[model samples]
Target: MITTTGLTKVYQSRDREVTALDGVDLHVREGEVYGVIGQSGAGKSSLIRCVNLLERPTSGTVTVAGQDLTALAGRGRRAGAELRRARTRIGMVFQHFNLLDSRTVLDNVELPLEILGVSGQARTRKAKELLDLVGLAEKAKSYPGQLSGGQKQRVGIARALAGDPQVLLSDEATSALDPETTRSILQLLRDLNQQLGLTVLLITHEMDVVKTVCDSAALMQRGRIVESGTVGELLATPGSELAHELFPVGGTASGPDRTVVDVTFHGESASRPVISQLSRTYNIDISILGAAMDTVGGKQIGRMRIELPGRFEENVVPIGFLREQGLQAEVVDGDPAPKTPAGAPAATAGPAGTTAVPEQTAPPVKEAAK
Candidate 1:
């Protein structure tokens, strides 16, 4: 639904030139939720803003729903008529709620339709329906200042949909709220993506948000996308930095001789008991370090760090067995080690209900599929 080629954004100061985006190319498929993630200086904000021409790019092209937004936009900072009209079909939600404090919730939502010369009665009816959709119909008369942060964000979502947009751009829409509120907002976006068939392109610093909602994700660093792909593909790639970040399991290891391996499970492999089968087949005890399991878009995606009672050579057969079963098993610990302590369970739950592994970081890689 959205594509960018050589998308670069450069900012000029009196004595310096800074590039926020560097020859970036991205593709977000239709009817899917695509997440852009990075640290604060990673150019994540610039990329999303460029998508809708909110921050006009210094170079490159943006195509959405077959329309070239860059071509339709004016050469200057101000958007042209065609670009303005095109934007109506592309809605945006901000990190801050960006609501009009003076206007009531219903009035705030009606503003977008009003700009299109929609009649008062028609816009009012449409606004109410949107408010109901976001579960805020009863608060239509309340002003922005009177609502909680989550409620205000709901108002923002309702307003963004007032234009009946086909694409929704979320700029850290839940960053300001608490964890519980953040989950609520993310779930709402997921629901809207399914109900309206809206193609969502959101940028966030939080991996949890992406883990919970995005069908695919891109990782940005130093103004370039280092990784981009479906979540499953990322999980399946060994030493994927994005995958590691998404399901972190950092801690001190309890044993040095134990052979540790990180395994990724997705698709059919996620349903199988590969870990247990490995232990039974090899007759070697397995120790769980850390794990993260999530059901995204109704698919089970999981990453686990496990330890076997031997060196890499001794466990090669079991790892190969796991690979033949469609699991990505990479040995993280290779040194030979003593057997598990007496009476220790084969595995224990770690953070996020997955076994934990000590921190072993790596640089993010671009999606091979891209």
Candidate 2:
């Protein structure tokens, strides 16, 4: 388990001070894979580095596994021996595989143990076991250049685990690889988390990574966590920006007078035919504008945008009916029209002077859950 209270990190520049983290309070539960997702320059990297005291916070406290890491990290440019010993319990995997070209795969894994004064035979035995754990036992004699990107990362993972850490910190570990490799790496992290009961705190900009392996997630913006919760809680929230970003359902009402509503379905509701039931029960025709569906943590989740035949006032009963069916339905007022391509023909007006726009395709959803 990990907890950070009022964590703040400020960088000193010649001209101005840059605040990477601003009074952030974060908590990661034991044995849970927690994800921090944000765009570049959102302080994700700074926060993770601060967790291990690689970048000491300007202020606040960091507690990991019931130990106050911030207290152990005294005010000094270099870490003392006690702090160094404490860091062995926290493992870190980098985006770029930080393996030495001069060292073989087994040697790379043994580096950490060697630093801890592990004997030669013991280090070799531990490194080989780790190599086998990461499915790179046959590559022990190969150099870094001889391995693929994914293999090199496996070596990095084995090296990190040499310390037998209780917590694993991943800093964009899959960003450099291709999509297939990324998926494989994510799966490996999930496997490691379950197999070793590792408390994983990974920071990434990719929503697919969070959806795939995170038990809970926090969204960072401008060095602040704007939203944090379980994936199901986010999807069920009526106006959650993270939910909209995760499953982007894009569409607009063909006419301004029509009632447009956004609906979210999760858990048991996701498998039910709620839309058809709403249509048949109310004896009203429903036009689906767009929808996105995916599985997270082995549960199906979906978001949909639909249009009704009347104004918002007239569709109140139907919307209430949808809510009764365990759906998060909210009216979208004054839905913006879809933007046309430059020099493209304009949409023609339909009957009753309403512009007719074709349905927009929903964004692709990655089926990342195992």
- TM accuracy, model 1: 0.86
The digit string of per-residue lDDT tens for model 1 on 1-370 reads: 8999999999997899999999999999999999999999999999999999999999999999999999987765555878998999999999998999999999999999989999999999999999999999999999999999999999999999999999999999999999999999999999999999999999999988988999999999999998899988887765678988987754334665556777888898999888897776666788788888888667888788877785544554566577777877655632333233344323333323233222222122122112
User: What's the lDDT for candidate 1?
Assistant: 0.83
Give the range where candidate 1 is weakest over 10 consecutive residues by summed lDDT: 361-370
Give a tens-digit lDDT track for model 2, residues 116-145: 999999999999999999999999999999
Checking candidate 2 for backbone clashes, the offending pairs are none
Q: Candidate 1: where is the Cα deviation over 4 Å?
A: 75-79, 251-258, 333-370
Best by lDDT: 2
What TM-score does prediction 2 earn? 0.89
